[model samples]
Target chain A: MAKATSSAPPAGSHAAAPINQSLTPDDKIGLYRLMSRIRRFEQVSLQHYQGGKMAGFLHLYIGQESVAVGTISLLGENDHVITAYRDHAHALAVGMGMDECMAELFGKATGCSKGKGGSMHYFEPSKNYWGGHGIVAGQTPLGLGLAYGLKFKKLKGAALCYLGDGAVNQGAFHESLNLAALWSLPVIYIIENNGYSMGTSQSRSSAYPSCLAERAAGYDMDWELFSGEDIYEVRARTQVAIERAHTLSRPAVLEIATYRWEGHSVADANKEKYRTKEEVERFKNEHDPIQRWKRVLIEEGIASEEDLKKIDKEAQKEAEASGDFAKASPYPTPESIFEDVYWEVDNKTDAGQTGRHFFND
Target chain B: MPRRLSYRHALREAFDEELARDPMVVLMGEEVAQYNGAYKVTEGLWDKWGDDRIVDTPISEAGFIGMGIGASMLGVRPVMELMFWSFYTVAWDQIVNNAAMVRYMSGGKINCPIVIRGPANGGTGVGATHSHTPENILANFPGMKCVCPSNAYDAKGLMKAAIRDNDPVMFMESTKLYGEEWDVPSNDELPDGELFIPLGVADVKREGSDITLIAHGRAVITCLKAAEILEAEHGISAEVVDIRTIRPLDEETILESVAKTHRAIYVEENKPFCGVGAQIAYMIQSTIFDELDAPVLRINSLDAPAIYSPPLEAIQLPTPEVVVEKALSIC
Candidate 1:
């Protein structure tokens, strides 16, 4: 019943349509600001982790900021979101204020998710960001469901699902993609292919390592593969996918070729174990997304070097303030443990649970 | 006056009522549309509600189950039917990691008001893969509500309650009791909310003073039958407590009964290892050790995978005879 379950996308003129430019200079600068914030956020996040101010695994979205900034810029008010554990950049790019995002990493009460969810699980419902799911490919079906909700409500919104290269091989990921296509769900699934799934490189993990989006043909989904080092490139490719989903209510897949500048997480310091130091240095020195975007901002005259530098300073300062805000915020009181387990009252009423309970001595 | 209905009819009536009551309610699962349902619990729903409401999904448990939870997050009340309880392992991450922890981890920002309902016991000759009493496993999570209805009346009332609940509920039903009829209160006979049984409540099916027989799901019937047998054969008037909700387990009813009767014998269709009865035994013993006349005994299914043979399954699952033996031994 899947209309496009072939490995090769259906032959069409839309596939050959030229990528065009719709971004104004102001908008390009605005995107630069967004990318800059994510850049500073990850940079500060690493500093905080190394300084022993942060606990747990921290997957730095250093070179992968464009994927979140580019994909999230296309989303609207009602469009929902789902992403894997590498979510600080996604959350910040989606307008979950810098303080709240950093405070979440610090486990503060003011943080989104009330500090209950750490780095791997930040959710801001006002922004319609579903969660920061930890399980590999676990969030795929949730995005499929969010799309189903939009379709069920007959609304003009869609769902944007973000995953990593390693997640494409998970059973839930394939199942969700197939169903999203078969049901004509309004969803755009973006893969942040940093070449590695944890310590295992995609070449070692996936049976097919060429382009993860090419696998979308098996599910009858429209697919695209593009380099994400350029913010314009990522934005141009994702806009087409987003529009197709909103207009035709179909599923699309985008695989962005990016690189992780750091080790697997804040916990991993041995960079020479799995990957070469020269390779990491090459990607960082030559193909950095922030540096590439900064050059564009200067060359296009969207902003002068001083304006760009001012924006950069402001983003870094904001990232610093987020750490202070988290440090000043309080933790959840111990007595509140029993709260929020259930709605506590009967449906839509203040009447407490009518079910009988034992008398605790 | 109350009307007679089978367990299947009671469940179908509940679904019809909820669907009519809430426009956001949608029922989706494998074979739920044209083929009715694998168990036919959702029969005729596809035609009445059409494709939008009653969706027949492809054979994908992880995808649809996760979708149900995700839809609930967006204010859609999804009542997903698992063909069998044993299939839940395939969607374990959705249930355990996402559905159960969404509210707690999200800091109560959003809740998944989804209901996952289906047959979840070992009497249908459905072999090892098909048969699993997963009340303990599901109830083990903190933010989950596991409801097991014993009879038709309880099934209808608890089904409505689970739907109305603003949290994720694991609504477990029985394949063997689908055709069994009971005196379920019809719509006109009951007042609004009278037929709605809230979760975390315990129901007393039969009252006695000599001993207490506690159980849940289809095992409640076995407990009642055993109570009758105990009364006639051994002059043991046994009280039967049906645990409607396993997680917010009604600790008061069991403790009160144990205190009054001074003897407790727990029964369950699940395996003995980490079974529902194990918790009941420990809780009762810890709370009322001085009140007990004898040790808190347990009668559970054989600690093995469900067998296909009727005779073997009969021996494997707890029976009236086993309940009687445990009751006598405890008394």
Candidate 2:
């Protein structure tokens, strides 16, 4: 069972992982830098949300950084990426511009989706990042559709659909998973099982709360589980799943066990209300992804402690500069209110001219 | 003048033309491929386009419909067929929240070029669950286009236009009119993309001077039959105006007709509560109150579930006799 209060072993203290210095020096540094960027992006955005400079619900991906960092790093330029509202990490991982992402959260014109999408609805079709969907499991079917499109067009591309533990209970989740498997769609579904569905724990939410991967058999798809806290493990398992989708044109499900350092959203102010401070502090000390990866980089001799801090400083500066860029950007104009509602209809003229109640001729 | 074809066949021809014209155009729905469609509209399409283009999916409305929207977002022109339009209720969020809002939310970065085609009517006695005319519901979305065709010609013409449109379109067809034959042009006459009819434009099916019968879909045909009764039996010339597209509604055509006739009666198969007629009736009375000879009357289906009994079903829905009687009541 996904016993939230069960006496489980400490996260990183499970076993002393054999340090693998197998990767080249540049690849090691590059992967580490990518994680740093994602980490800084979420940190800077969380700061803005807490300071009341930004609006709307801001869900931080502080702890479960490796799942996004690991999986997105393996995707090709032609592939599509879609995920839930906690998507600041996914957007940065998919190579979306930092300034534009910050602008989007800032609700500025220069944002990838202008000011319309806000933070939760960030869309960059150019980069094939569909959007940061607001509703739970809302993008599951959409992701299947993207896969179906690729299959229809005979394109060598697949869609990466990311979901959370909460989304597993939604009807669209089962419906989409079944259809994708039945149609032999080119898609990979990654479940970031961070154990909490907002405030309600998975123990209360799901029937088989402990095992999301076990349910994939009913849909006739092979499933796997990975440690989301371990970046390399996430990458290795995800690479296998992606290869299955790319080569065999089959859908695969991988559940990554992770944790959220903060509350579900920035609005969930009382983080200590549901989770104990000891539990949060223990994970931070034991298996924090950033600390683990940094340790690996140093002990493996790929980069020195001083060298890692220099890279971290660069990522922090870049994230802070993007915040400055967002603050400097302007809001969308009022005339743009009637724009983009329809494809060819001139909403400014057409809506103003018709589709309303007029008292007189 | 060119050739006669059934409304269903005309729709299939439009699909055939678009599929041949563009490689991105594909058809998908339940029973659309191996079963050749529930109504035979997609009878031989699977044989022609094969599985790659003509995809048959299991009954998962929310899944496949949303998938179609996603595919359309990525530059595929998907014509997704729902067996009954009432089934759209299952995928309400996908249609209204996702597909309809994606383009606007994306700030016009992506266009959902999709057409959700199916028979949306109540005359076939498919019971309340299966038989629902959801044009008003579909038209309610600002980002979505709603197209209802009354004849083979309009079916062919508007299907062409809807497939070519760069936005999500709800192509409403009538189950009662699928087998009805009309002067639908041959491929030679229409050529590639020649029979395209602009959405939101109304057609004056039968011209008159006394009273106007504003209707759409099957109601357009009912109004035409009612016009014959009014002219022959009641000695009244009733003009039948077909409000083809309901979303970007043709107010100019409606206003001009009501202004000339000075009397109008709105007709539709949907319930009177928030029906298409209600909107048009509001437009007519509000805009041209001085020009009206009487209140713009609305003749719609009785506010109840569609019955399985044919007699009860006919009684609940608007028919030619009901429309004629309403026209005489106003005049």
Displacement of the residue A115 alpha carbon in candidate 2, Å: 1.0
| Model 1: how far residue B5 lies from native, Å | 0.6
**Chain A only: TM-score per candidate:** 0.90, 0.89
Tell me how large the interface RMSD of candidate 1 is. Answer: 2.2
- What overall lDDT goes with each candidate model? 0.85, 0.84
Which regions of candidate 1 fall more than 4 Å away from where they truly are? A1-22, A345-361
For model 1 chain B, the run of ten residues with the poorest summed lDDT:
B186-195
TM-score of 2: 0.93
Q: Compared with the true structure, what per-residue lDDT tens digits does model 2 show for residues B155-261? A: 98889888987878899998889999998766566556367777778899999999999999998988999999999998999888998888778888999999999
Go through the candidates in order and give the C-alpha RMSD of each one to the true structure: 3.3, 4.2
Least accurate 10 contiguous residues by lDDT in model 2 chain A: A1-10
